[model samples]
Target: MKRTAALVALAAVPVLFLGVFFVLPVSGMVGLGLVSDGRFAPGEALEVLGRARVHRVLWFTVWAAALATAITLLLGIPAAYVLHRLDFPGRTVLRAAFMVPFVLPTVVVGIAFKHLFAGALAGLALDGTPVPIIAAMVFFNLAVVVRTVGTSWESLDPRPAEAAAALGAGGWRVFRTITLPALRTSIVSAATVVFLFCSTAFGIVLILGGLRYATIETEIYLLTTAHFDLPAAAALCLLQLFVVTLLLYAAHRARAAAPVPVERRAPGARRIRRTDLPAVLAAGVALVLIAFPVLDLVTGSLRHDGNWSLANYRALDQVGQGSLVEASVIEALVNSLRTAFDATWLALLIGGLVSVIVTRRSHSPTERRVRAGLDGFFMLPLGVSAVTLGFGFLITLDEPPVNFRDSPMLVPIAQALVALPLVVRTLAPVLAGIDDRQRQAAASLGASPLRTVLTIDLAVITRPLLAASGFAFAISLGEFGATSFLSRVDHPTLPVLIFRLLGTPGSHNYGMALAAAVVLAATTAAVMLLVERLRVPGVGGF
Candidate 1:
């Protein structure tokens, strides 16, 4: 009885928190759009479905996402193979450096890409085109494929492949027979994630595509803010939810069907083979392409009025940021840091509690399925996107019990909703992987359950917890879609301020935007690098 009570109490924390913050808000916003005059309208839905513009936007979104996913796979698969198969100088360093773009704020990426292709600094700018937008999606998504696929690729045993090769199998035949089948699961998982990200891309589409291009994401922003068509925005949100859910369901099925076998050998420690050279060289070129815009952003930040200058950064101390945004760059940074701190605490607290519940005593298949459902519940925020949360907050939080519409707390609450998934993903695996022997040993030594958890489980989970905290912080710092919509005018975040600065017309505004973007990117990279140093070998998605 006591044990059941404790489990229920532990589960209540995350359930209540997520229910109020994430579930209610999303339901409110999505529900309001699905109804007309408080009545369900099947005809309204059909009208939205039949609209020519809606179909156009939806189809374009599909085409763009498909093309972008294909490009990412073509680039990322060989890169993953190199990282998995070869030993080379600075290889780990190269891998870590390449990861910078993935964590970078989408707004900052848009800024860097715009300047590289459209600014006078590049001599041959490529702005206001689908090419730059697709390129930006590819830039941000390559790391996802490389990291996800590389993890599985590295652990694969080579004996089967070697035997097949020795038995008169050719290069392609050996790979087709052994390697391809083994890697299909990771490839599909990676590809699904990349496709989802590209499909829901916002800042890259907004900035690079100019005023003409519109995904369902950007259209929601346009309909809500620019055109004041709330109903249309809500309908678009529904359409987006439907598409994303179907894709997620498919990915889940694929992953469950193709389970990866455990490998007993150390990854990437095998003898180097001749075929690795091409993979290595391809990874090298990919790294250069990944690093170019970031390095160029740094250069642009320091170059003011055609010469090296600190004027752009120094002006961060003043109000308006040389734009009409009213907030200084320093203030924006402070707001972002503050939000990251609060959001990380909220996510870790709630996510850790939920993870404990999910990892708690479970023997039956029914119990395991319930735990899995709970896990997916926390992660629903990622699939739903921050834009939906922001919209939901506006629609739902004006009432008495949850009336935080005017408060600054909503900023990080939205961020926590987004960060909670990563926190759980980081901590749950470690928690579940805890050996039963350790706790049994502690109990044998007369340790209480509480003491055993503190001593054994806490010690093991601390580093991954810290890494999770760092990820939450980095994610909050770089968040743009929701922040742009939800943040208060006077208390804008760094990403929001950068977006505003980009809109103002002046050399100073442009330069300052570049400087702030570089600062944001650099800080995110620093956090990731620090966490990488602290991370253990087989933890969560770093």
Candidate 2:
């Protein structure tokens, strides 16, 4: 009973925080959708649901997500296998390269894709459609495959593959018969994650697609904010929520279906054959795939009027002739930095506390239940489309108890919501690795609980803590969807600024947008480098 009480006390913080912030906001959106103009409109919602356009958009969303997932898996499985099995030089560097797109702002990605495939970009052309956008989406999300599958990839024992080879199975047969089965859990996990990203994708679709295409997310934003059709927006939100819920349910089942096999061999030590042509070619292609987009962004930023010049960069601070360019670049940059910093620290504190509490009682049933429930809620912000959350926040924050309709902190708070999951996932594993014996040793030595954490726990967690917080900071810095929804008219972030620049039909505007995107990309890359430098021993960095 005493232990249960203690567990409850610990779990209370996360539950209360999530109940107020996460659950209430989403619930309010659903309520708003149903109780519009004072009376319920379930029939209107049902009718909207049956619209042909809605069906078309839903079909498009599923197809696009599936395509993206397939692309990630095709490229990622081999890449994951190579990284998991190969012992070569630059392995860590290759791993970091995979993670770059995951951290790059979607808006920046969309912009980069546009620039890459634009008529003026190295005179390259790709049939004048949004094929570039789809390709970019697949490339940008490849990290999901590597990170998720790579974890399981690392955990795989190579003896199975080796034994299969000894039994007269060819390399292809061995991979199909043995390696594929061993990677089922990681593949499913990675695919679900990639699908979630693709379905809810906004900035990439907006920038690369323009009016040519729209995901469910971009359409919702366009319908609600641009058209002011709350009903249609609500309907879209509901449809999206249903689909996402189904996807997440599939993910949950995939997770439950596969039991991770015990590895007799060290996962880190696994490697692919050095002379394998497929592995080498895949690695080379991946390197080019990752490097070219960034190179395109950088080169575009530096060139101007058929000659290299820094004029576009120099004019980053000036506001232009319309509402789209209402805010200066300096203002946007400062606002982004300030807000991202605050949100990172805020998330670190809240998420870290929740993680520690969740791990405090390993054997308490009540604690386990509470942790599981809270975990789902915290992770909901990740899977729940950003546009949905943005609309929810807009409706709920306009009146009453919390009026942040015009608040500056609103953007970062949204960023924090998106980033909190990253922080928790990163820190939770590190915290879980803390042995009970260490705490018991401290306690036996007359250390109080606080002191034990301060000394023993602090030493172990500091490195991962830095890396995690740094990742949260980087994520918030480049975050775009929530930034678009919550950005105050007077203050914009770098991404919003870049989007506005790209929206205009002038060379200078496009050039300046490219410049700002270059800056955002460079800033993100530098921070990731910092994260690696600060990574604690034995705990993987950001």
Candidate 3:
């Protein structure tokens, strides 16, 4: 009974936070579309789904996400094997380099791909086509596959494969029969996450595809903002919510079905062999694919009017020509920093409570089930469309009893919710790994529960806590889709400002956009680099 009381106390803050910020807003948005004249009426919304344009958007979203997931797996598996299973010089640096893209802002990625296609691959004419959009998706999601699969690959026992090899079984035969089966669970989880990200992608599609090529995410934005079609947008939101819920459920089942290992083994990375050439080559290709757009973005920012200059960087202090924006890039950057600072603390507080609530050793079946439900509940933000969240905030939080239209912290609160899932993921595994006997021993020694947690949990979770903070900070810095709807014109985040610069005409505006993207990318990369240095296990994996 005491333990139940403690669990309830621990879960209260996170529950309230999500209830007010996540569930309420999403429910309000869904209600807006389904309810009419104080009565439930989904007929008009359902009719919108029958339109030909909606079919095209739905078809394109599914096919594109499927294709991107396939390519990511094909490229990521070899790279994951090479990076995690082989010992090589500069391997750590290379791993960190690959991870930078995953943390980069989606808007920055969209701009980088735009620069790459227009500048380096101009002759190929890939710009304004689905090719760049698909490539961008691959580039952004490859790290997820690498980290998720690589973590699992790193810990697998080598004895089984070695025994098979000793029996005259070739390497391919061993991998096909033994290694692949062992990796199936992690591969499936990674693919599901990558597919979820690709399907709900907004900034990349909006920037590269425009109206010519639209996905469900961008279409939702267009319907809400341009078409003023709330019912249609809300209908699409329901569709998105349903799909994401299904994906989350599938991932949960896959994880639950995975067999727990009877024995644990230390990582057994070996020196490269003759047979590793294919994997090495694939890793090299993956590196090139990651580096090209970043290189183009940097080079494009440095050049202006067919000549190299720092003029673009110099213009960061000014709004673009003809007052393209209300705030300068530098000012927007300061706003981003301040907002991220607020968001990091909020995410850490809520996520820390959530981690503790879910990781505590449950003494009863009912308690364990409740904890499991809460864990899945917090992860809804991960799969839900960010645009939907942002749009929902606008409609739901603007009226009496919950008015936040003029609140400065509204954007940070939304960003915090988006980062909460990552923070919980980062910290929960670390907390769960702790030996419960240590806590029991501490309690037997007459230490109170608070003292036990402070001495044991705090000691173990400090580095992970810091790491989660950095993740939240970096994600908030690059957040765009939600910020787009919630950020005011006078206090725009850097990403919002960069997007504005891209939309405005003039060479200077374009140049500034590139420069601003470089700044945002560098900031996020630096944070990720520091997080990597902490060497926390399962920091960024799914």
RMSD of 3: 1.5
RMSD of 1: 2.1
> Considering TM-score, which of the candidate structures 2 and 3 is the better prediction for this target?
3
For each candidate, what is the lDDT? 0.83, 0.77, 0.90
Q: Alpha-carbon error at 191 in model 1, in Å? A: 0.5
Q: Which residue pairs does candidate 3 place in steric collision?
A: none
Largest TM-score belongs to which candidate? 3
C-alpha RMSD of candidate 2: 2.5
Best by lDDT: 3
Better of 1 and 2 by lDDT: 1
Q: Candidate 2 lDDT, tens digit per residue, 108-133?
A: 88888777777445455672365776
Off by over 4 Å in 3: 258-264, 539-542
Per-residue lDDT tens digits of candidate 1, residues 1-61? 5555565567788888889988888888777777889898756766766788788788878
Find the 10 residues in a row with the least total lDDT in model 3. 258-267
TM-score of each: 0.95, 0.93, 0.97
Global lDDT for candidate 2? 0.77
Better lDDT candidate (1, 3): 3
